[model samples]
Target: MDIPAPAPNGVQLHAPGVAALREAAVGLETAFLAEMLKSAGLGQHRESLGGGPGEGQFHSFLVRAQAEQIARSGGIGLAEILFQSLMEARK
Candidate 1:
Protein backbone atom coordinates (compact mmCIF):
# COMPACT_ATOMS: atom_id res chain seq x y z
CA MET A 1 0.00 0.00 0.00
CA ASP A 2 3.03 2.23 0.28
CA ILE A 3 4.27 3.91 -2.86
CA PRO A 4 7.67 5.58 -3.00
CA ALA A 5 8.16 8.86 -4.77
CA PRO A 6 11.15 9.49 -7.00
CA ALA A 7 14.23 10.92 -5.37
CA PRO A 8 16.28 13.72 -6.84
CA ASN A 9 19.87 14.99 -6.56
CA GLY A 10 21.09 11.46 -5.87
CA VAL A 11 19.15 11.43 -2.62
CA GLN A 12 17.34 8.18 -1.91
CA LEU A 13 15.47 6.59 0.93
CA HIS A 14 14.53 3.08 1.90
CA ALA A 15 11.43 4.36 3.69
CA PRO A 16 9.99 7.24 1.74
CA GLY A 17 6.39 6.26 2.27
CA VAL A 18 6.27 6.87 5.99
CA ALA A 19 5.26 10.48 5.48
CA ALA A 20 2.12 9.59 3.58
CA LEU A 21 1.25 6.95 6.09
CA ARG A 22 1.76 9.33 8.96
CA GLU A 23 -0.40 11.95 7.26
CA ALA A 24 -3.19 9.46 6.69
CA ALA A 25 -3.07 8.38 10.30
CA VAL A 26 -3.18 11.96 11.50
CA GLY A 27 -6.07 12.75 9.18
CA LEU A 28 -8.03 9.83 10.55
CA GLU A 29 -7.37 11.05 14.07
CA THR A 30 -8.50 14.53 13.14
CA ALA A 31 -11.77 13.29 11.71
CA PHE A 32 -12.43 11.21 14.78
CA LEU A 33 -11.70 14.14 17.06
CA ALA A 34 -13.97 16.38 15.03
CA GLU A 35 -16.86 13.99 15.45
CA MET A 36 -16.10 13.68 19.15
CA LEU A 37 -16.15 17.44 19.51
CA LYS A 38 -19.39 17.65 17.62
CA SER A 39 -20.97 15.09 19.90
CA ALA A 40 -19.69 17.01 22.92
CA GLY A 41 -21.64 20.08 21.73
CA LEU A 42 -18.63 22.32 21.63
CA GLY A 43 -19.94 24.15 18.57
CA GLN A 44 -23.58 24.33 19.38
CA HIS A 45 -25.18 27.65 18.54
CA ARG A 46 -27.23 29.40 21.21
CA GLU A 47 -30.32 31.27 20.11
CA SER A 48 -30.05 33.53 23.13
CA LEU A 49 -26.64 34.58 21.89
CA GLY A 50 -28.19 35.64 18.58
CA GLY A 51 -26.73 32.63 16.80
CA GLY A 52 -28.72 31.95 13.67
CA PRO A 53 -28.64 30.04 10.47
CA GLY A 54 -25.22 31.34 9.43
CA GLU A 55 -23.66 30.52 12.75
CA GLY A 56 -25.13 27.06 12.66
CA GLN A 57 -23.70 26.53 9.22
CA PHE A 58 -20.22 27.82 10.01
CA HIS A 59 -19.94 26.46 13.52
CA SER A 60 -18.94 23.10 12.17
CA PHE A 61 -15.96 24.66 10.43
CA LEU A 62 -14.83 26.13 13.72
CA VAL A 63 -15.30 22.84 15.47
CA ARG A 64 -13.36 21.05 12.78
CA ALA A 65 -10.47 23.48 13.09
CA GLN A 66 -10.40 23.10 16.86
CA ALA A 67 -10.44 19.33 16.49
CA GLU A 68 -7.56 19.51 14.01
CA GLN A 69 -5.57 21.54 16.51
CA ILE A 70 -6.31 19.05 19.25
CA ALA A 71 -5.28 16.18 17.02
CA ARG A 72 -2.07 17.97 16.11
CA SER A 73 -1.37 18.39 19.81
CA GLY A 74 -1.20 14.62 20.39
CA GLY A 75 -4.94 14.32 20.89
CA ILE A 76 -5.63 11.18 22.97
CA GLY A 77 -2.37 9.76 21.51
CA LEU A 78 -4.40 7.91 18.87
CA ALA A 79 -2.50 9.40 15.95
CA GLU A 80 0.90 8.35 17.23
CA ILE A 81 -0.22 4.82 17.99
CA LEU A 82 -1.90 4.57 14.61
CA PHE A 83 1.19 5.83 12.82
CA GLN A 84 3.39 3.34 14.59
CA SER A 85 1.01 0.50 13.86
CA LEU A 86 0.77 1.44 10.19
CA MET A 87 4.53 1.70 9.85
CA GLU A 88 5.07 -1.66 11.48
CA ALA A 89 2.40 -3.28 9.38
CA ARG A 90 3.95 -1.95 6.20
CA LYS A 91 7.28 -3.41 7.23
Candidate 2:
Protein backbone atom coordinates (compact mmCIF):
# COMPACT_ATOMS: atom_id res chain seq x y z
CA MET A 1 0.00 0.00 0.00
CA ASP A 2 1.25 3.44 -0.84
CA ILE A 3 0.73 5.37 2.33
CA PRO A 4 0.59 9.04 1.44
CA ALA A 5 2.08 11.93 3.35
CA PRO A 6 0.06 14.08 5.71
CA ALA A 7 -1.85 16.90 4.13
CA PRO A 8 -1.68 20.47 5.34
CA ASN A 9 -5.44 20.64 5.77
CA GLY A 10 -5.88 17.53 7.96
CA VAL A 11 -6.82 13.87 7.91
CA GLN A 12 -9.93 12.24 6.61
CA LEU A 13 -11.33 10.01 9.34
CA HIS A 14 -13.21 7.69 6.95
CA ALA A 15 -10.67 7.16 4.24
CA PRO A 16 -10.98 4.01 2.12
CA GLY A 17 -7.51 2.72 2.99
CA VAL A 18 -7.97 3.21 6.71
CA ALA A 19 -8.78 -0.42 7.43
CA ALA A 20 -5.88 -1.74 5.40
CA LEU A 21 -3.53 0.74 7.05
CA ARG A 22 -4.65 -0.36 10.49
CA GLU A 23 -4.18 -4.02 9.63
CA ALA A 24 -0.74 -3.37 8.21
CA ALA A 25 0.21 -1.39 11.29
CA VAL A 26 -0.85 -4.20 13.59
CA GLY A 27 1.02 -6.76 11.49
CA LEU A 28 4.15 -4.64 11.60
CA GLU A 29 3.90 -4.24 15.35
CA THR A 30 3.37 -7.97 15.82
CA ALA A 31 6.41 -8.82 13.71
CA PHE A 32 8.52 -6.26 15.55
CA LEU A 33 7.48 -7.64 18.94
CA ALA A 34 8.08 -11.19 17.81
CA GLU A 35 11.60 -10.33 16.71
CA MET A 36 12.24 -8.67 20.03
CA LEU A 37 11.00 -11.72 21.90
CA LYS A 38 13.16 -13.94 19.75
CA SER A 39 16.22 -11.82 20.48
CA ALA A 40 15.54 -11.94 24.21
CA GLY A 41 15.09 -15.69 24.09
CA LEU A 42 18.44 -16.13 22.36
CA GLY A 43 20.31 -15.14 25.53
CA GLN A 44 18.91 -18.02 27.62
CA HIS A 45 20.79 -21.28 28.04
CA ARG A 46 18.17 -23.45 26.42
CA GLU A 47 20.70 -25.71 24.77
CA SER A 48 22.86 -26.50 27.80
CA LEU A 49 21.55 -29.82 29.12
CA GLY A 50 17.96 -31.01 28.79
CA GLY A 51 17.05 -28.85 25.81
CA GLY A 52 16.98 -30.70 22.52
CA PRO A 53 16.51 -29.77 18.87
CA GLY A 54 12.77 -29.48 19.52
CA GLU A 55 13.34 -26.56 21.84
CA GLY A 56 15.02 -24.62 19.12
CA GLN A 57 12.36 -25.66 16.62
CA PHE A 58 9.45 -24.40 18.72
CA HIS A 59 11.08 -21.15 19.78
CA SER A 60 9.66 -19.21 16.85
CA PHE A 61 6.13 -20.44 17.53
CA LEU A 62 6.40 -19.42 21.15
CA VAL A 63 7.66 -15.99 20.23
CA ARG A 64 4.84 -15.51 17.71
CA ALA A 65 2.21 -16.49 20.26
CA GLN A 66 3.59 -14.14 22.89
CA ALA A 67 3.84 -11.31 20.40
CA GLU A 68 0.25 -11.82 19.26
CA GLN A 69 -0.94 -11.81 22.86
CA ILE A 70 0.98 -8.65 23.60
CA ALA A 71 -0.44 -6.98 20.50
CA ARG A 72 -3.95 -8.00 21.45
CA SER A 73 -3.37 -6.40 24.87
CA GLY A 74 -2.67 -2.91 23.43
CA GLY A 75 0.87 -3.69 22.27
CA ILE A 76 2.60 -0.53 23.50
CA GLY A 77 0.02 1.39 21.41
CA LEU A 78 2.22 1.22 18.32
CA ALA A 79 -0.57 -0.11 16.14
CA GLU A 80 -3.03 2.58 17.08
CA ILE A 81 -0.50 5.35 16.70
CA LEU A 82 0.58 3.92 13.38
CA PHE A 83 -2.98 3.65 12.20
CA GLN A 84 -3.63 7.26 13.07
CA SER A 85 -0.46 8.46 11.45
CA LEU A 86 -1.15 6.51 8.30
CA MET A 87 -4.69 7.78 8.17
CA GLU A 88 -3.49 11.32 8.61
CA ALA A 89 -0.91 10.89 5.95
CA ARG A 90 -3.45 9.46 3.54
CA LYS A 91 -5.31 12.73 3.80
Candidate 3:
Protein backbone atom coordinates (compact mmCIF):
# COMPACT_ATOMS: atom_id res chain seq x y z
CA MET A 1 0.00 0.00 0.00
CA ASP A 2 2.71 2.44 -0.89
CA ILE A 3 1.39 5.73 -2.19
CA PRO A 4 3.30 6.90 -5.19
CA ALA A 5 4.66 10.39 -5.42
CA PRO A 6 2.54 12.94 -7.25
CA ALA A 7 3.26 12.70 -10.92
CA PRO A 8 4.00 15.43 -13.48
CA ASN A 9 0.48 15.36 -14.82
CA GLY A 10 -0.76 16.32 -11.38
CA VAL A 11 -2.02 12.83 -10.93
CA GLN A 12 -0.99 11.50 -7.58
CA LEU A 13 -0.85 7.78 -7.60
CA HIS A 14 -2.76 6.13 -4.83
CA ALA A 15 -1.32 3.67 -2.38
CA PRO A 16 -1.80 0.07 -3.41
CA GLY A 17 -4.59 0.15 -0.91
CA VAL A 18 -6.19 3.13 -2.57
CA ALA A 19 -6.20 1.28 -5.84
CA ALA A 20 -8.16 -1.43 -4.10
CA LEU A 21 -10.53 1.22 -2.84
CA ARG A 22 -11.03 2.51 -6.35
CA GLU A 23 -11.78 -0.97 -7.62
CA ALA A 24 -14.23 -1.46 -4.82
CA ALA A 25 -15.86 1.81 -5.76
CA VAL A 26 -16.37 0.64 -9.31
CA GLY A 27 -17.73 -2.75 -8.30
CA LEU A 28 -20.07 -1.32 -5.73
CA GLU A 29 -21.28 1.35 -8.07
CA THR A 30 -22.13 -1.27 -10.65
CA ALA A 31 -24.00 -3.50 -8.26
CA PHE A 32 -25.90 -0.61 -6.79
CA LEU A 33 -26.93 0.79 -10.13
CA ALA A 34 -28.22 -2.64 -11.09
CA GLU A 35 -30.28 -2.85 -7.95
CA MET A 36 -31.70 0.59 -8.44
CA LEU A 37 -32.70 -0.13 -11.97
CA LYS A 38 -34.33 -3.35 -10.85
CA SER A 39 -36.16 -1.82 -7.93
CA ALA A 40 -37.41 1.05 -10.02
CA GLY A 41 -38.71 -1.47 -12.55
CA LEU A 42 -37.12 0.37 -15.41
CA GLY A 43 -36.47 -3.26 -16.28
CA GLN A 44 -33.32 -2.55 -18.22
CA HIS A 45 -31.68 0.76 -17.22
CA ARG A 46 -32.37 4.42 -16.81
CA GLU A 47 -31.56 6.96 -19.40
CA SER A 48 -29.21 8.12 -16.67
CA LEU A 49 -29.00 7.80 -12.91
CA GLY A 50 -29.84 11.40 -12.40
CA GLY A 51 -30.85 13.45 -15.37
CA GLY A 52 -28.04 13.89 -17.80
CA PRO A 53 -24.33 13.72 -17.51
CA GLY A 54 -22.83 13.76 -13.92
CA GLU A 55 -25.98 13.58 -11.87
CA GLY A 56 -25.99 10.87 -9.30
CA GLN A 57 -27.17 10.93 -5.81
CA PHE A 58 -27.18 7.29 -6.64
CA HIS A 59 -23.48 7.49 -7.44
CA SER A 60 -22.73 9.07 -4.11
CA PHE A 61 -24.60 6.25 -2.46
CA LEU A 62 -22.35 3.83 -4.25
CA VAL A 63 -19.26 5.64 -3.02
CA ARG A 64 -20.44 5.21 0.53
CA ALA A 65 -21.16 1.58 -0.19
CA GLN A 66 -17.60 1.19 -1.46
CA ALA A 67 -16.33 2.44 1.88
CA GLU A 68 -17.77 -0.67 3.41
CA GLN A 69 -16.13 -2.78 0.75
CA ILE A 70 -12.83 -1.15 1.53
CA ALA A 71 -13.23 -1.87 5.21
CA ARG A 72 -13.94 -5.48 4.37
CA SER A 73 -10.91 -5.70 2.12
CA GLY A 74 -8.44 -3.71 4.18
CA GLY A 75 -9.92 -4.03 7.63
CA ILE A 76 -9.73 -1.21 10.21
CA GLY A 77 -6.07 -0.75 9.38
CA LEU A 78 -7.04 0.99 6.20
CA ALA A 79 -7.92 4.00 8.29
CA GLU A 80 -4.63 3.71 10.13
CA ILE A 81 -2.73 3.45 6.88
CA LEU A 82 -4.37 6.59 5.53
CA PHE A 83 -4.07 8.44 8.82
CA GLN A 84 -0.41 7.53 9.16
CA SER A 85 0.31 8.90 5.74
CA LEU A 86 -1.60 12.08 6.51
CA MET A 87 0.32 12.51 9.76
CA GLU A 88 3.61 11.98 8.01
CA ALA A 89 2.83 14.50 5.29
CA ARG A 90 1.85 17.07 7.91
CA LYS A 91 5.26 16.92 9.51
Candidate 4:
Protein backbone atom coordinates (compact mmCIF):
# COMPACT_ATOMS: atom_id res chain seq x y z
CA MET A 1 0.00 0.00 0.00
CA ASP A 2 1.17 3.55 -0.75
CA ILE A 3 0.90 6.43 1.74
CA PRO A 4 -0.14 9.95 0.75
CA ALA A 5 1.74 13.07 1.76
CA PRO A 6 0.47 15.18 4.64
CA ALA A 7 -1.23 18.44 3.83
CA PRO A 8 0.38 21.72 4.84
CA ASN A 9 -0.77 23.58 7.94
CA GLY A 10 -3.54 26.22 7.52
CA VAL A 11 -4.10 25.18 3.92
CA GLN A 12 -7.26 23.70 2.49
CA LEU A 13 -6.78 20.05 1.52
CA HIS A 14 -9.01 20.57 -1.49
CA ALA A 15 -8.22 23.10 -4.21
CA PRO A 16 -4.99 24.29 -2.71
CA GLY A 17 -4.24 26.19 -5.90
CA VAL A 18 -7.21 28.47 -5.26
CA ALA A 19 -6.71 29.08 -1.57
CA ALA A 20 -5.57 32.63 -2.13
CA LEU A 21 -8.39 33.28 -4.54
CA ARG A 22 -10.85 31.86 -2.05
CA GLU A 23 -9.51 34.16 0.63
CA ALA A 24 -9.81 37.14 -1.67
CA ALA A 25 -13.33 36.22 -2.60
CA VAL A 26 -14.30 35.84 1.04
CA GLY A 27 -12.73 39.18 1.81
CA LEU A 28 -14.73 40.86 -0.93
CA GLU A 29 -17.88 39.30 0.39
CA THR A 30 -17.02 40.47 3.87
CA ALA A 31 -16.57 44.02 2.67
CA PHE A 32 -19.84 43.91 0.82
CA LEU A 33 -21.60 42.60 3.89
CA ALA A 34 -20.00 45.23 6.05
CA GLU A 35 -21.28 47.98 3.82
CA MET A 36 -24.71 46.44 3.80
CA LEU A 37 -24.66 46.21 7.57
CA LYS A 38 -23.63 49.82 7.83
CA SER A 39 -26.44 50.85 5.51
CA ALA A 40 -28.82 48.85 7.66
CA GLY A 41 -27.68 50.81 10.72
CA LEU A 42 -25.83 48.01 12.42
CA GLY A 43 -23.54 49.14 15.27
CA GLN A 44 -25.18 52.54 15.13
CA HIS A 45 -25.34 54.41 18.42
CA ARG A 46 -28.80 55.47 19.45
CA GLU A 47 -29.48 59.03 20.50
CA SER A 48 -31.44 57.80 23.51
CA LEU A 49 -28.66 55.45 24.70
CA GLY A 50 -25.90 58.01 24.01
CA GLY A 51 -22.81 55.79 23.74
CA GLY A 52 -20.79 58.97 23.00
CA PRO A 53 -17.53 59.52 21.08
CA GLY A 54 -16.03 56.15 22.01
CA GLU A 55 -18.96 54.27 20.50
CA GLY A 56 -18.79 56.41 17.40
CA GLN A 57 -15.11 55.64 17.05
CA PHE A 58 -15.56 51.88 17.50
CA HIS A 59 -18.81 51.29 15.60
CA SER A 60 -17.02 50.62 12.34
CA PHE A 61 -14.87 47.98 13.99
CA LEU A 62 -17.95 46.28 15.42
CA VAL A 63 -19.62 46.30 12.03
CA ARG A 64 -16.53 44.84 10.39
CA ALA A 65 -16.25 42.04 12.93
CA GLN A 66 -19.94 41.19 12.50
CA ALA A 67 -19.54 41.11 8.74
CA GLU A 68 -16.53 38.80 9.03
CA GLN A 69 -18.47 36.46 11.29
CA ILE A 70 -21.39 36.45 8.86
CA ALA A 71 -19.08 35.63 5.98
CA ARG A 72 -17.46 32.80 7.94
CA SER A 73 -20.93 31.41 8.62
CA GLY A 74 -21.59 30.90 4.86
CA GLY A 75 -22.92 34.39 4.14
CA ILE A 76 -25.63 34.64 1.51
CA GLY A 77 -23.66 32.27 -0.82
CA LEU A 78 -21.75 35.25 -2.15
CA ALA A 79 -18.30 33.92 -1.25
CA GLU A 80 -18.93 30.54 -2.87
CA ILE A 81 -20.16 32.14 -6.08
CA LEU A 82 -17.29 34.56 -6.08
CA PHE A 83 -14.81 31.72 -5.56
CA GLN A 84 -16.32 29.76 -8.44
CA SER A 85 -16.11 32.80 -10.70
CA LEU A 86 -12.50 33.40 -9.70
CA MET A 87 -11.61 29.76 -10.44
CA GLU A 88 -13.24 29.96 -13.83
CA ALA A 89 -11.45 33.18 -14.65
CA ARG A 90 -8.11 31.70 -13.62
CA LYS A 91 -8.63 28.82 -16.02
Residue-wise C-alpha lDDT for candidate 2, range 6-91, written one tens digit per residue: 43345554567666777788788889899888787642446466787667767677788888778767787887777777766665
lDDT per model, in order? 0.76, 0.70, 0.46, 0.76
Candidate order by lDDT, highest to lowest? 4, 1, 2, 3
Total clashing pairs in model 3: 0
Model 1, 1-91: lDDT tens per residue?
Answer: 2322343334333568867776787788989999999999998998988866788899889989998888777788787778767766776
Worst 10 residues of 1 by lDDT: 1-10
Among all windows of ten consecutive residues in candidate 2, which has the lowest summed lDDT? 1-10
| Candidate 1 positional error at 2, Å | 19
User: TM-score ranking from best to worst?
Assistant: 1, 4, 2, 3
Q: What's the residue-level lDDT of 5 in candidate 2?
A: 33
Report the error of model 3 at residue 15, Å. Answer: 2.1
Candidate 4: list runs displaced more than 4 Å. Answer: 1-17
Model 3 lDDT per residue over 1-91, tens place: 3323233233344535545544444454445544654565533335654465544435555544554455445533544444445434534
Q: What is the lDDT of residue 73 in candidate 3?
A: 52
TM-score of 2: 0.68
Instruction: Give each model a TM-score.
Output: 0.80, 0.68, 0.32, 0.78
- Clashes within 3 Å, all models in order: 0, 0, 0, 0
Pairs of residues at least 3 apart in sequence or in different chains that clash in candidate 2:
none
- In model 1, where do residues sit more than 4 Å from their true spots? 1-14
Instruction: Spell out the clash pairs found in candidate 3.
Output: none
**Which candidate, 2 or 4, has the higher lDDT?**
4
